[model samples]
Target: MSTNPQKVHFIAVGGAVMHNLALALAKKGYQVTGSDDEIYDPAKSRLENAGILPQNIGWDESKITDDLDAVILGMHARKDNPELLKAQEKGIKIYSFPEYVYEQSKEKQRIVIAGSHGKTSITSIILHVLKYYNRNFDYLVGAQIEGFDLMVKLTDDAPTIIIEGDEYLSSALEMKSKFLFYHPHIALFSGIAWDHFNVFPKFEDYVKAFEELAEGMPKAGAIVFDETDNMVDVICEKERADVAKLPYGAHPYEVKDGVSYLITEKGKVPLKIFGEHNMKNLHGAKKVLERLAITEDMFYEAIQTFSGAAKRLEKLGSNAHTQIYRDFAHAPSKVEATTKAGKELQPDRELIACYELHTYSSLNKDFLPHYADKLNAADKAAVFYSPHTLEIKKMPAISAEEIKKAFGREDIEVFTQKEELENYLKAQNWYESNLLLMSSGTFGGSDLNKLTEMVLALPTNKKEKAKPAAKKGSVLGKLFKKKS
Candidate 1:
């Protein structure tokens, strides 16, 4: 809160947003310093370039001096962190990343996008449109979006700040959901699907968090939500009477030659991004932009060039006959929606969907049943999980049979090794086919772009051909195949 150059220290600066925040503060002439036990590329490189990278890898209590203006705690830091203890003993003010962001944008009109899925895409679209119109706004998006150098941006003089409100825990000490602290003046709720099993163990508890978000909005504040979701409808109807409520759904769209076009009053506007869920996200973003006085024409023009947030249906590589996409879709609902979208983009081509069980929720045996039939849209479905990951998480070993049973599909293939999964994919003929890899974590550090190229480089005639179909209800058909 100091007007002059303040000394800010980050406890865990290696995080995606944490490093960005450190760089942003440094750029604003603040004396910024941070420490992290392990720093990954991009974050490490960016922080080092900004000259804010910690001299050592571990926590140093000496860095937490009384002269420091404020200490920003990242979620990755533990309650017993030495620097955190020192800051507490010194009576220095400490704030979680979300709490600090709220403090910086409290005076601005905050626009928050909240949902278990599609929040990143919606936030990306809003930022894209605002940037295109030359609007002066600060933003904190989850993913690295196009045209934005950093994921977190803060300035002294922006009238508006757009935020992607995550429903996860604020910090190790806070335990409160991050979105609850933002106090959004204009909020958009895409939909609530049960996620983050480690935090909200019960489905009702997860839904209640979103309800609290709606209830926290100030009087006269506006809320835009997806009306198609029954849970969202119930929450908005019951808890949002004090605020103005607006509902939106999928915009009218048509896909031509593998390109999706949004049908507007102006005409068919072609889009770089495709998917029914993305179209719905677009509609939600449109409503939010309308509240900001951004015209429909401006929204249409800007959104046509918006590729998408990184790792959200991002096209890795493509050939004339085939295309390869990678998406951050670990939740069951996201997997289903993304798989269906990938299949719909090229309906005539064979769709091969491969998903990795990476997140704590997805790797939990109890939560595996939720994914049943989620990948049914794909012609050939595969699930991959690293046994080492389960060991590291201290979870019990899971069998391929268990995964197959959980999926309720007898034909689904499961792999425990990344190399085997990669080889299996390379063995398939990719001509006139589409491949979608969905996961929150990398498939055990396998290079997706190289694998995509390997598949595209295969000879089409050397691979197995599709089998001919038989007539339904015949005796031979009953013996050969099962009914859908």
Candidate 2:
């Protein structure tokens, strides 16, 4: 390591990824300094503990020195940010989050998982399997997996870097999609769906970004994609002949008594996570790992203990009769998949799916039609959207009737107030039922832990008798005991 490590500054360090990047760089012996208009914990505590927390909250143009090696810009920082201007004036090289990641891992084999939905899950699975066998690798996962301490890992010695590549914009300065910069040697295209309406307004416009990513693939690079997805199939089929096309679909699995197990020649491998979507994710990950020297047997062995990526159908609380899940499923495709997965997990149990139309796209009346039949899988469905949220986003107000009609479920309940929604959920008969809460935003700032506790404490319907508990020596009973 050099005596004077390379200096880098962050314009908006409060961001989840930006703060983690700053911390990682600091741990790598870099002189890290950053500023943001507002700082929040645990980023605040982590940065302060590292002795790199800015003296003041807002940006300081004086901190931008000509000697700084680079300036890593975050999406939170605007084009007119003073710190960015100062860095530009000083000719300090600027890099977006993806750009900096690529700069660091340019020499390594970059295996990027690109998609609108399953990118995080597939990336997390690959990372979990690689780490289980002690494979030398760096990674950038979207959400925190249990074994990993941080979402992003950059190391000089790792031969490969697995990145959860999002199709969203890199930064305000860079209008291009983030995944376009990775130039992955082994790319996994999960599936494409229309999202980020503020960025790519039209479905075709959104698809074009992914098309560009596929067209730019280097020769001999392997592209593992979902053959079931028509858009992905078209993109991969049209790619240059030199780039190898590897297609995969959902792995075969069976669900019995509320548990999903993968069927193998040797035996059935029980999984902590369940769903057809997840099975596809697992298969996609397996294909990517096979190219990296992970055997089919090895992947199955390691994946059994793999729970799931955080907030991607993550279990919040579970009892004998009821389970509550919190998913980051703001988009139409994500909501549908997650809702269906919840029902599949417990076929006999009633599924009460509650969704929050919180994102800019989901709130817009023009985009409401995209959610048609999305929540039909659930036995009961409820959609909540804050009028205040619409006001904040400067979007037109959407009526409850529009939401019900858009979902193609006339009987579906819609709520504007979080309190009323919470009350409705509290009033539900949780006996032999599972609840799925799908949203990107907090349900009107509701504390989910408290909400879950209240729901769990609610009494079952007096009309129906409770079903007999699972046998003490049964597989389900054993699993529950182990979890406890």
Candidate 3:
């Protein structure tokens, strides 16, 4: 917390967020050192360039001598880490990543952006807008945004700190939610739904964590929430009565030519992305900018060029007859919003949508039903998930048949083998149709860009095979009725 360039040692430094924070600190002239049981490329190269990459992976307790100023624990480190134990025995100070974030920005006006979904997008949008307007602010984002170098930063001259607030627990030592440490002067909760079943264990308990985020704010602070999300609505209504509360519902919007238009006081603003959910995201970002005194025109100008974060509705490839997009949409609400958005954006075009059941909740049979009718808007739907993922996560096994049954779509195809799916897609008729790949993880190691390019290059209407390989006895015939 002082000007002294403290000797900070990170327990696990290979994480995307961790590496960025380490870089930010080192750039500020801090003496940063780190250890990771397994440090991969990018992070490895980054640390090495900074003269901080551990000589080898794994905890080096001998390196945790009393001379070290403090130990910043990463969530990836296990509770029994030998270096951690050594640091504890040495009576060295310890801080969770979020705790250190708070210490660095305690004197700034903190705006913590949070929710079950869309936190990264909102944070990125806000950062983009701030930069466009030439406002001075330190910030943090969850994902790798387009124009920013790192996901986190701290600067001395900035009067404000904008953060992507995750509700997950701080490192094992800090049981409180990470956002709780920020004590925001201004905040935004995109929405709340059940997630991190391994942590909260219950829907109500997960909802309660967000409630605590709102309750953590000071009386003079502000909280902006979604008025349409019943869960977020309930939580915000019950939060501390003294905090300045603002409610944001869906924006006044319209869709034309596959672009969404937000009806602003200045004029109707056209957006590259389309959906009711994204309209809500825009409204939430607008309310936050209003708190910082950003006018309607400035917000619109900056947001018009902000083409979402890396994987959120990222365009893979496109041609005259077909287009493909990959999105980080795994939660039930996110799946429904993204699938419906793609379909609505091109009502006349055939929608061939595919999703992977990659998350722990999605792979669980009980959690699969929430996806029922979520993809109904798509003309053709398929669910692809790797059975090995469940084993890797140490959860029960899940089969393709179970997923097909869970989706409740007799026509929805299922695949455990990624190659089988890829081969079928490559040989299929992609003409006059739009494809949407919805998943938080890759489809069984398939190169999304390469596959998308191959599909997009195919002629719109290829010459017909007598029986069309998709005959009743063909590989895909068993999965769907092939209405087309």
Candidate 4:
């Protein structure tokens, strides 16, 4: 840490959080310069607008000067990155993204939200309430939360910093989990489901990471966890006796006309977000607020306007009769939870759940069985995967039958091409139906807003018309085409 304005250079600054951090540091008057082999939109445009985009795309050792205050390395950068080697040779301090986040918030009360499924939503809720009440605390969330310009923020005067603690590896050179470096004074584990198989291959090893997080809490620190998860329950109970353990479950609530309201002693508090998982997330967030002395009334007041984090059951576009939602849910548990929530919110509407198998874990043959019966709630279910993705990851080719068998749903539709899937969806009558699209990646780069508009613009009166029988050699037939 330097007393004067810091000169921070990022090795791979085009990442979602990395770019945001570079911007935040620059906003704080730090001379931020960064380089990445490639930069993508949003990150690229943002960095360019901030005037911090690298003059060139590739690495330059000259950028790693001895005068630089510190070098923040993104996880995407490899150990052999030329600039990193130069910084090492110069004896300049280098920090991983998580290491840098911890370093910045070391003096403040670090509140970390860690879990596989709902951590982002939980962190967003806490930040929403904190911001509504005019609390001046810094935060590092995983998503682009509304009202917050940057995903990572660090200020000199903020007394607290809330962090979304991801369980993935810190960086290429650092095999440690990112959350392990936070040293949380107050931590919350929403729930744990095996994820990031590329990192933690075994289930036991995945669980161990969270157990380490729980055990690492300070003597007087507090931990709030989802009691519904048996794994989390056991871990919290076994934690050090000196640490305070708090658990939360789904808050009592009732849904009316597709709107959910939380039942409270004061009165019914209307919530902009819905779902059993979200209710549970709300309870977990409330527990964190309670520890911070945020009264029940204040929590309710602030939470009423909290829509949700972007892409977590976000209502992209809706018409009088139909609604479209998109969520960043590729993991089996998340897919199950999000789909069930959508159905619950609009019980009368026909639910059409479409999920994309995009992540390394979701695409792994060994991990496919975890999704069994996850989409049973939807009236119609569809799963999409890109053949190109498998090739890119160097994974063994998986057939539609394998996916169908893994889901244990013989009737579940599987599509290999984005065009066929979009066509099938377009043919549907969305008059009284709700569409839920779940994927960690875009459905093979399909534009969701345009799709939603197409759906909404469909003729509602066509519901009574019978769809034509599929041709033997049509696109729908090719979905079931066997591999040569």
Model 3 misplacement above 4 A: 1-3, 462-484
Q: Please give each candidate's TM-score.
A: 0.95, 0.94, 0.92, 0.94
lDDT of 3 at 174: 81
lDDT of 2 by residue, 291-361 (tens): 99999899999999999988899998988778999999999889999999999998888888999999988
Residues 418-458, model 4: lDDT tens digits: 89898999888888889999998889999988988888998
- Evaluate all candidate structures by whole-model CA lDDT and list the values in order: 0.89, 0.88, 0.82, 0.90
Per-residue lDDT of candidate 1, residues 1-484 (tens digit): 3369989999999999889989878877889999989998999889988898888898899998878989999999999999999999999999999999999998999999999899999999999999998899999998999889999889988899999999999888899989998999999999988899878888889999999999888988999999999898888766555789999999999999999999998799999999999999999999999999998888888888899999999999888878999999999889999999998899888898999999999999877777776787888889999999999999999998887777666677899888989889878877788899999988888888888888888777534547522212323223323421
Give the distance in Å from residue 360's predicted Cα in candidate 3 to where it truly belongs: 2.1
What is the lDDT for 483 in model 2?
A: 48
RMSD of each: 4.3, 7.8, 5.2, 5.0
The TM-score measured for candidate 2 stands at 0.94
Better of 2 and 4 by lDDT: 4
- Ranked candidates, highest TM-score first: 1, 4, 2, 3
- Which candidate comes out best when scored by lDDT? 4
Task: Give residue 235's error in model 2 in angstroms.
Answer: 0.7
lDDT of 4: 0.90
